[model samples]
Target: MKRIYLSLSLLLLVIIGSRAANFKFAFLTDIHITAGDSIPYNDLARSVNQINDTPGIEFAIVSGDITNIGDRQSMEVVKSLLDRLNVEYHIIPGNHETKWSESGVTDFARVFGSERFKFEHDGILFMGVNSGPIIRMADGHVAPQDIDWIKTELDKAGKEKPVIFITHYPLQPGDVDNWYDVTDAIRPYNIRLVMGGHYHKYMQLEYDGIPGILCRSNLRAKEKTGGYSLCEVTPDSIFIYEHKIGNVPTRKGAYSMTGMNYPKSNAGYPRPDYSVNKEFPQVSEQWLVRSGYEIFSSPAYWDKKVYVGDDSGAISCYSATDGRKQWSFKSDMRIIGTPAADKNVVVFGSADMNIYGLNASDGRLLWKINTEAPVLGAVTIRNGIAYIGGSDHKFRAIDIKSGTVVWSYDGVEGYIETKPLVYDNLVIFGAWDKNLYALDKKTGKEVWKWHEGKPGRFYSAAAVWPVAANGKVFIADPERVLTAIDASTGKTVWRTKESMVRETVGLSEDKRRIYSKTMNDSVVCYSTTTDFPEKIWASNVGFGYEHAPSMPVEKEGVVFGSTKNGLMFGLDAHTGKVLWKHKVGNSLISTLVPLSKNKCLFTATGGEIGLLVIDYKINKHK
Candidate 1:
């Protein structure tokens, strides 16, 4: 009887080990399958066969770009090839599939079941969304309906197990126009990691607070071999391995589900109730504009008029006092960046790749200049010249009066998205190329360039606007490192070891303190008065990582910050202690505009084109 009991115990151990075996699957991204493209088809066929022959791949996920064009024939070709695979598969749409395609999402859904899907495999919840707009080409947008659908899915499965999201584009703040909205929507869910494509390069990233993994294209290109990845997921940890065609697999990396500092949903990882006794600030007035579309552009205040743009391609001017609509003008595409205003004209860039000089008073277009790609950065006007950058990887100095290019600099390799800071005869801006460049304002010549280390590149480019003050240029990057560099020599003064700061750093008017929002859901105040910067204090800002912290403005020793989660905080500037917190709207993107010592204009995205008048006189945070 004792011997029989020992044998039963040993059998139970073996059963438990087999049950807890790691779940593995293949990830193929950016296949770019096209009709008549024999090379890609052949390559995909080989990959499918190899994946089938591999010992332990449960399934595969083709993370977008399955077809080069969104056509019936193209999708059918891809479907036939994928059907030959032994393992089941899933896919999402990429820019190449939707951009410039007539059928767009319809063809993809007909062939692939749905553009967005949610499924459970090996006890892990996988969610994917079509990162493409059916109408537009080459832009990342998850439809409003998808947002609601994801919320429902999260409600059902977010608390059950670790969740993984797949997108054709990385969900970083500035990669897509409205990444913050999507991030905020998912912040309340248990998202362990996000997988994306489109960059066509492997990257390990932390956006806000969630881990992001970008996969390379599976199509063999010039000087580059095709590849895919296999991820092994256990109940507690995940390990990834990269495999190139005709080569052995290499261990990519590994991470734990619960041991990470990642900001997770409260449903999955509950925290102590910080919302207790949290009193929000009062709103004097809330005005909803008739154009009830999404607004991503920061409101530009000039001549007592608030100039802003909505996703519906309308730029409107309103009275700053009562929020009365003054004049509205329509563009061919969406306006993204904040508008720059001189005395008479307001200059801004649009997604349609055009820059416009508009009459700030009457909302009339003075002139518009066409660029090679979408112009995302705000127009910086100095001495009659408008300095702006575009997705075309060129920075052009345009004549603001005539709307013509005076000079163009094509040295940068990535898209330019930051507002150009004009300082000491140089145009300073950060680009997606992972370099901070200072160019001569007049001649468009490179004055100096600086990267983080040894000219190495980060995954996504730099999109943070550089704050130049106190002889230093303060900026942040996608790598989650914030640096303060000497403005004169372009040498690093001090770099912080923190991760997940994408917005421009906030500086105290006296330049003694710097405030930044981190990926761990906290607003930290750093002391810059010393020789080396050090963290003074960090105040928790609820859950999820906010991309942009409203350039913390200080008045009467109280610092104010608006987070992307739509929560505004009034913290003691010296202690980083939360004096009060307020939920303003769906999501806050830009810094707050302090109208007076006790009042500020807070703008947000998601609902309409209007500002919330936040009066601090009566509701001062004690």
Candidate 2:
């Protein structure tokens, strides 16, 4: 009887061990396939063939950056190649897929079926989500909805089953703006490992006791052929091996998958410091609210109400005085552009391929104009006409009252995303085609088109909203140059790389100076009257490596600007003295709307909406 009992116990132990481990899979990331790139396409095809040729590989996990430019054709090409894999594969998008997206970051979802994924295999739950800066150039963010989804999935999986979290970026403060939020959500779960691949190399890291593995990219770089990682799971550990095409797999490292004790609190982790807010006793938040969705545009203020659109295609109205929800209207797709308001009407464009005009008071749709493609451009209202551009390579002037197209220009070679500047009878805007265009506001005729002599669309004057004063149009682009163009003839009056500014510019209310945020740690002002690029003042606000396109707004002697890291600061316009700085959120702050010198309305890409007010009495005493 004793011998029989011992034998049964041994058999049970073997069964448990078999159930806990023994699986193999392929891991690929940062494929970066452009539609016509033969190398990337060939490398991806080889990797697929290799995975198929290898035996005992159950499935695959593609971390992100499946395409180089996030274009629809590139995505479809990637899909066709990936579909050839014999095993199933799960994928997500990286910053590359969202930042320069022509479809407003919607083509990935349309091609891949979802931006996130979740599946269970062999008693272990696997989950993947999108870590994005979205349509703007900022730090990556795990959207609030995605965090909630992770929590729900983990809760359902319970604490007993091991889990693996997959994303594009390594969960760090610099890589992900809200990394702490993600760590906090997964802390209570049985998270075994986190896998990502943005650095294009194999890396072993730890985020508050959670083990992380970053895979090498599939690009060959200087090597003869591209490569990927093969992962094998055992009862006690997971081993990673780098497998290059036409070569043997080299073992990289082994990570323990058992007995991880994640920290309950991020006590010693570095976080965004709000100490600057304490330095300014006068400045305080009046009221703050979270929209629960990503917001890419600034708020539109009209008649004591604030209108803002979000990534979820919901345009919501809030009481401008005290952060109360008034009403909301829903569209079919994401609204990435800011809404423009005039009189009782608010107009905005949606990625659903429609421009909408709504009654400002009740959030009711008054009129909708259909377009051939997504309308990602911000609406500019001037004299009851709405000037906007679309991805269909057309710009239109619409009558806000009657919802009819006053004029349409079909000559733009690329999509438009900036708010058009109506200056001196011309509607001025930039497109991704590497040109700044000036069109007649009434007739939609091209006055003149200006190019920066740069080849790439990234160097185009596309993101900056052209500002004109002193008969010259001032603009900045990704080439890190500030340019002053002849407003009438589109001639380059003066262009300077002296300050290293990129895509953020604004004009002073007095029109004496133009304010631009530098790529590093300063905000430089240029004299609008000078034929040469003359620097008025360069204030080093110490924001550190800043490149957000949040245009500075000057009002009543104060110039207000925000950063990619959610810092809002006020500077003296004439002297460039730092007045007061406040850290608002952990993401990019949009262009601020100054209600007065003491009050301002602001929103952030992290779903933050609030009013900032300065108590003059408190400031006076200090």
Candidate 3:
């Protein structure tokens, strides 16, 4: 009687599992809706209508890149269109929405109800979370908090339930900085497949033996009409098809999910190569610390201490000689801007909509000034005043001691992110409104404002920290053009794309040369005294196809710069000759602080803070 009862129970389980796996869903991505762009808007609308009209589709998943510029207006348009779908939908933000976000990435949650989603349907658990570089240009990263959430959700699903993971970028080294952190977490679970939508094409991929799928964009690129994909799941296999607007569905691929192995080992997968550190035996890390959180800003130095902030809203102070934590203070939100220190006080801004001043010694809160919106701009200190900008369209000068607003400039048209260049009685900074403004530092009055000819904020002079010398201000914008403006008149001295420089510019200590990194593998120098861009020298450093906004710093005749892929290098300040290149990690390196010609302190987006030092023997021989 017991054997007969057990056989009947096994049969019942098989019937329920087969019924649960049989379902169909729609997969749409990269709609890229702009405010006045009728093509993409119309394409997304047609796709929504088609999904509503389809009979067997149960639900839909829109994986990221919902807006073109990540503004409030464009996100609203996307929301209205997605709301018209007949089936329930889940969505996440892509790089386009997070990198250029006008609200410091807060508006996405307000419009979409959340930045992540998870739901169970027909006994299968589906989960999605955001992978972002935040308001800075770097590689995609899964936030520490979000990683914890992913582990919790996957654990609750247990090792016997089928799970599908969703994200914007592929789980690879170049696409996501901490891809291993995610793949390792899900590898232990009964993962069925991974889905993403960054490359805007349909492709089959494998990440350490796990099946992955990349979806196409909804925008009609070179085609008459745009479309999305249809996914069908069965008891033992899953099939994907491309459904063009007004056309029949074409089968893309099919893969079996049953009898697969879980918890794959990381034996053969390619990881970030740190062998470059072995090649450059002269350079080594003096001290290193891992915060386990994404760090977007650079490190600021005070009296014998290094101060840095991370995405967790914590500001920490460490000893300069040895990387030991001295103290830390926490805020209510993330800190995406670099802090400025002067007169024993450290000041920084947070997405919590507050600017804080803390004691340099103990990390005690001196004071905080609230703003109407998130403060994403770096701080600049000049003669006891802290100059910073916020998304509220205001630039302020605050007293370091009293925590009171000394003056406010309310004419900024867009949010500011670069540090103000306090040079020659003027505070110079760039905004997302395609303009750079110079204000009188003493009176808080506008000195001059210069606008780029480009139409969109993507090409605006907003990311690079402006450098000034020889009666001119030098800036590099995203349009691959370097401009030299007259310091006093706000007129263009010369604008040139001859070198093809992006948003990374630095000035020499002697104030005779300006250094910049090109879009390809070269570092070029320009004479500050020349009327036009005069190339001093160009060195091929072998950092291929780099586009990070981290500025170079020169100290004691050694020029130090970092790349988007965790490479920190030094060059001869005069000849542009590569001195040494070290691979610190596999993420974007923030701006470096050169303590001396032999040692430098650096931070990266992947939560690594370390001190790079030349070996004592090598320095002695030199």
Please tell me which predicted candidate would have the highest lDDT against the true structure: 2
lDDT of 1 at 312: 54
The local distance difference test score of each candidate is 0.70, 0.91, 0.89
- Candidate 3: C-alpha RMSD to true structure equals 2.3
Better of 2 and 3 by TM-score: 2
Candidate 2's TM-score = 0.98
- Candidate 2, 384-437: lDDT as tens digits: 999999899999999998899999999999888899999989999999889899
Candidate 1 per-residue C-alpha lDDT over 1-622 given as tens digits, one digit per residue, 9 for 90 to 100:
9999999999999886675678788989888877898988887887888788888889889888877755567889988988987888988888776542433134577688877878887567898887654322113556555777788888887464678889989876435545655777777666778888888888898756678888777878773557788788886777777777778888876767554446654334322233522454455345545345555555777777788876556788888777788898887666666777777788887777778888888988899888776676766788888888876778888877777888999998765656788887788987656678989988999988988743433333254656666677777665667778888888888887564565546777677877777766777777765546677887786746555524566766767676554565667678877666656443444566555534555556543444555455545534
In model 1, what are the clashing residue pairs, if there are any?
99-137, 432-461
lDDT of candidate 3 over 1-622, digit per residue (tens): 9999999999999987776668899999999999989999999999999999887899999899999878889999999999999899999899999899867787898899888999998888899988987887877888877888989988888888888889999888778877887888788888888898989999888876778989999999999999999999888887899999999999988877677644468778777888877767789899999987888899999898999999788999999989999999998877888999999999999988999999999999999999998899999998899999999999999999879999999999999889889999899999998889999999899999997668867788999999999899999999999999999989999999998999999999999999999989998999999898898999898888888899989999989999988999999899987788899777889889998998899988888889999753553333
Candidate 2's displacement at residue 292, Å, is: 0.9
Q: Give the C-alpha lDDT of model 3.
A: 0.89
- Relative to the unseen true structure, what is the C-alpha lDDT of residue 220 in candidate 2, on a scale of 0 to 100? 94
Error of 2 at 343 (Å): 1.7
Displacement of residue 97 (Cα, Å) in model 1 is 10
Per-model TM-score versus the true fold: 0.62, 0.98, 0.95
Task: Give me candidate 1's TM-score against the actual structure.
Answer: 0.62
| 414 Cα displacement, candidate 3 (Å) | 1.8
Which clashing pairs does model 3 show?
none
